[model samples]
Target: MTVRAVRRTSLVEQAVTELRRLVEGGEWPVGSRLPGEVELSRLLGVGRSTSREAVRALIAAGQLHSRQGLGTFVASIAPVTDFDRQLRRAELAHIYEVRVALEVEAGRLAALRRTRADISALRDALAAREQARGAAELVDVDLEFHRAVVTAAHNPVLTDLFATFLDAVRDASTEMVADQGPSPEDHKHDAHAALVQAIEDSDPQAAMAATRHNVEHTLAQLRPERP
Candidate 1:
């Protein structure tokens, strides 16, 4: 095999590439703090300015987030493309429209495909939601229930796309929960129970109906008539 020389690139670009590799390769996981600029510069054999520029680039690209008084941390391994940032910034109604479309299909598919393990996971999430004591805890558990349903659909691409909307979903849920007075039951407990039953019974049509009911109920709560 003939050896090929590596093409040269700017130090900042090289640092950015290596930093991405470290993050994507799981050497640095999401939410894990990254090395300081001085340490990263020494580690990557680049100047501190180059390392700082690389970090700034990653921050702008949404792969890293820096907290005041805290070091930089990996925000996500999945690069937030322009489209994804738009999705993240989308209005609740727009995001819910897409969420309803995706989840209705996911509910049907999950009913047909969910395994025993999936059912168990869904039950656990539901139980957690029931036991949740505060608005924040309920929001987290509520999202977990939706995530379990999507996972049960057994579609990796759907799962990834849904994952990107989670922060927006969480924000919406927080607002809705706060507006509705922090009662977890105010957020579709019966509809979710029906959904779980439909999925457990492997009834696709029932699952779809249950999913639609839940989405519509949420929309009504968030956008009450002004009459």
Candidate 2:
């Protein structure tokens, strides 16, 4: 297991924060250059080195950029919103509910009618996931597997509904995988293999059970633990 590092704040951080506010507050307008080093130092009442460090900090923070001779300018006036702030608990709750409803039906249909080509696609997806280089690649291939399941069901509405939540679903999966850390993520593949076998045998009840089990287990993993 890896231990996360404890970080110590530095004066450069304060400089970065102050400079960010100055630019974001429109004291330095978008596309407008800041005063030269000497002038900025006089205005901010800081030494040349301190002002330079502050400027560099702002650049790294995405607030400003410096040209060799043209000097530092505000890059943009875009307002940044944290995704964490916008994400609602209820929305996440509903995502799982929707998954359970859609996937159970998809699993049933996949068992009844999955073609040889459909089985091949699912196998390819699992293979790609097994060979995934990083969390991003794993998430991509994992999504492909789920999408293949939906597609194999031969229901256009189910496929379209799954596509609608694809982005958020990807984000949620990425977050969980990152928190859980690394593959072979402990029997997850086994669960998928069971579902595949059910589908191959054309056993609707068994396929539905396997799909529901996987989704419910994912929901449990997503819940916060009590202290």
- Residue 51 of model 1, lDDT score: 81
Clash pairs (backbone) in predicted model 2: none
Residue 86's lDDT in candidate 2: 34
Per-residue lDDT for 104-167 in model 2, tens only?
A: 9999999898999988887887677667665556666777877888999998988988887776
Model 2 spans > 4 angstroms off: 1-90, 179-187, 224-227
Clashing pairs in 1: none
Cα lDDT over the full model 1: 0.80
Report the C-alpha lDDT of model 1 over 57-153, residue by residue, as the tens digit: 6765678876755788999997877576545434556767777999999999999999999999999998888787645566778889989999999
